[model samples]
Target chain A: MAQITFEDLSLSFRVRKGGKIGWKDFIVQGLRGKGQDDDWLTVNPLRNINLSITRGERVGILGNNGAGKSTMLKVLAGIYPPTVGKRTIEGTISSLFDLSLGFEYDATGWENIRYRGFLQGETPKSIEAKIDDIAEFTELGEFLDMPLRYYSAGMVVRLGFAIATSAMPEIFIVDEVLSAGDAAFQEKAKKRMNKMMDTASLVVLVSHDMSLLGEFCTRVLWMDKGRIKEDGPAKKVIAQYLEESRQQQAA
Target chain B: MTKAIAATSDYFTQIWQMRYFWLSLVIKDLRTRYRGSVIGMGWSLLHPIAMTAVFCLVYTTLFDVSLIEYAPFVLSGMTLWGFFMTVTHEASQTFLISQAYLRQNPAPLAIYPLRTTLCGSFHFLLAMLVLFVYTWVVQGFGNLTAFGYLLSSLVLLFVIGWSMACCCGILNVLFQDTQHLLQVFMQMMFYCSPVFYYPEMVEKRGMGWLVDINPFAACMELIRAPVLRSEAPEIQSVLFAGGFALVLLCTATCLLARYQRRLIFHL
Candidate 1:
């Protein structure tokens, strides 16, 4: 029973005016008093998000840049706690965002597989069991023996994707990682994702690729300014989203 | 009370469950730190040994202290101080160093500080071994029973180091100047502490209160009593060190609880 519920959730954080005040400025500000609000900007990345997601649903999120798609995904992944209201989740979650961010550049690909696998909650015995399968999927052959710093961007993405998707999680969350690799890798990645979607109890994805969403998602959520603008069948919602974007461009 | 206990136990369980992840990271840190160096891990030992040699020469020649007595004393003090310095300095950068992992996975925030402390402990233990062998060669191990107390003192120091790292790591993330501020503060502390000089020198100069209030001074006494004089650490020093460790652990826990989820945004 995989479920996710967000009830009137909102997240806001204060950003200092000059990128973090120094100790001296902090003291001066304390002494001056009262007008310190001028030195902070409150950013509301999410606001009053009310939604529920259940098992066996392949959902795609559609939004423009800074539309809170990634922020919502992060909240769903439990990376960010809401500032107001509540977020409740059940079942194990595996998120595949920022794929290229966490690799140890000094460690070789084989070592990275172990490191990333451990982070994904795989035990040593479990990782050893699946190591060969993950290695085969990446197709980097001799390159896996070399340190990650020497690998090209595309190669790193392949390794990251392969290791990340190895876990059989109850819920899968992804964010715009499919745009990086070459065409052949993309095709293979799609096949792998389709296979994962079949077994995964629920899947939530954020991508700008409407055609990809139309093909893979049963439902689509169109987000605008931290709120869900439209939620409907994949084809219908993506059509409305595309229609609005086309109208704006023509205007 | 039960709920709090359950939550605390749950937190520890989460940390225990992710042992492989953090442990592997600690090993990777240790490996990369010495990878290209010709002397490799010996570099950690050489730093304290070299400083001890220089201090021994100056003290024996100018201060008219006996080499046999002063060498082990200064060496042990330098080794302990080195551990304290390394742990706090590196801990301040722990969050930034693991920023990538923090963004990717939601492991317990304390593990990052633990990683830094474990690395520092490796060096500390290695240096302690050197001090042990040096003491045995010079004075033939004065009090065998006193050596048992070192075990408890090491545990206390480890707890203190971990807590300090946690607090410093979180503070550094919030205020980017924390590491710099800490460096200047530590410099002041080094002079205030009896790192190279005798603890009695401060007392003779009518400033025994400095030793009485200084937690580092208490720590020095804990290590020095057993290693230098072959006497068990006084109960007062032990209690002070233990009490200080508890206070810091509480502070670190509270800070982590408040900032664990929010710290990601700042990073």
Candidate 2:
């Protein structure tokens, strides 16, 4: 069985139209248009998309804003089912999408890590035994006893990263969290990810860093307008993508 | 059938994976709720006390009802009602508030709502302890045996709270106005249930059945009997309430699991 597959997946979100319709537009359309009035409303955030991911493969998804990178991650994580399509995911999975998703800011770092680690599928006994290791990795050390709200954004990212990745899963799904954090933490994160690559059966990462994509991923998936434009070796696909982007800029 | 099997396995796996997270959530929820300045968690007790005071004044002074005969009456109803209302409000919003967590881990969405309801009930245990102390000090612990009935009533309230929370939690995701709507519903229910007035106070013509259908009324009747030195609650009512709660919980769990992921888009 494949580790993950999204067949003709479609997920859309409806945002309530803000503000009253302008009177000027209403009157102008009424005068110029001949068709009946329409009350249908809402905008779709994600459209039909199809993709496949298999085991022992590191697939990297790249796309511009609103191009559906995050949406794809959510779908893969089962946070949002495809509005239309069949999805089959085999084995246990973990997500490192956003840092404050499960952590309670009002609680201490010790508490947040335990809660977050648990949410990520770590047992209490395991978490308790590894708290010191996680705490050391985060370098937040003594501050772990303090409320998370008191910590800076960098601190939050470090702790979140440590807790989430602490327990390796069969499949790990990470969003654009790498773009965050300071230089030192980023280096540490890369090193941690390198360690993960050694043990994880499959790792699906979404990042904007083409250079990093080349360094980590065996294959690259370039998404455009909710569809895969290229799915090939990291270096070749990223080079082609960059060339196309440059040409579009020039034009 | 395959989907169901897969889903069940995933649900159990999620439960195992997120057990620590849920336990931590419970602690965080309880700690944050009452961790502020003075009173601390004692305010958990204070809430029921203040509610009891309000009912005392409303029933005795305003309506000319007798508390001397009804002190236990108001205490039992309000305490149990407080537990029910608190759990309902908390559980109803559990998923909505934990959107961040839900968006990250697609495990059993039912766990979040259920965990919250359990947390709310835990606080109710504290408030129940206070009720025992208050009534004992005031009336001299007459029928300690009523503790059995009290225990059963609390369990009944837990069932109602858990079921209602699951229903409301799912509904609130679809409709943002559910919280406000529930507030109004609870207010109406407050007046409808025999919270302040005895069931006998109302003309017993056709409304007896109304009290039966109202789960809160059933809970109060059960609790009030033991506390007021009345007989044990009717076995039929207890069984009905317990059965009703179980059905609601199962239904809510199923719906939540089915719609768990879809909720992200709706939110």
DockQ by candidate, in order: 0.71, 0.44
* Pairs with steric clashes in candidate 1: none
Tell me model 2's lDDT, rounded to 2 decimals: 0.75
How closely does chain A match the true chain A in each prediction, as TM-score? Answer: 0.95, 0.84
Q: Candidate 1's error at B209, in angstroms?
A: 1.8
lDDT of 1 by residue, A1-251 (tens): 78999999999999987896666777788999889998889999899999998888889999999999999998998888899999999988878787656788989999999998998888999999999999999999999999999998778888988887888677888888876778799789778878876774788989998888998889999998988889889999999999999999999
Q: How would you encode candidate 2's per-residue C-alpha lDDT over B1-267 as one tens digit per residue?
A: 899889778777867666667777777777777776498888776766777788787768776777765665676677677766766665668787888777777767767766877787777677667666767787778758777777777667766776677788887776666677777888899888988787876646667776777877766767777767636877876777777778887887677766766666666
Q: Please list, in the order the candidates appear, how each scores on TM-score for chain B only.
A: 0.96, 0.84
Residue A82 alpha-carbon offset, candidate 1, angstroms: 1.0
Steric clashes per prediction: 0, 2
lDDT of 2 by residue, A148-228 (tens): 889887888888888777876777788887777888998898788777767746788898888778888899888877777
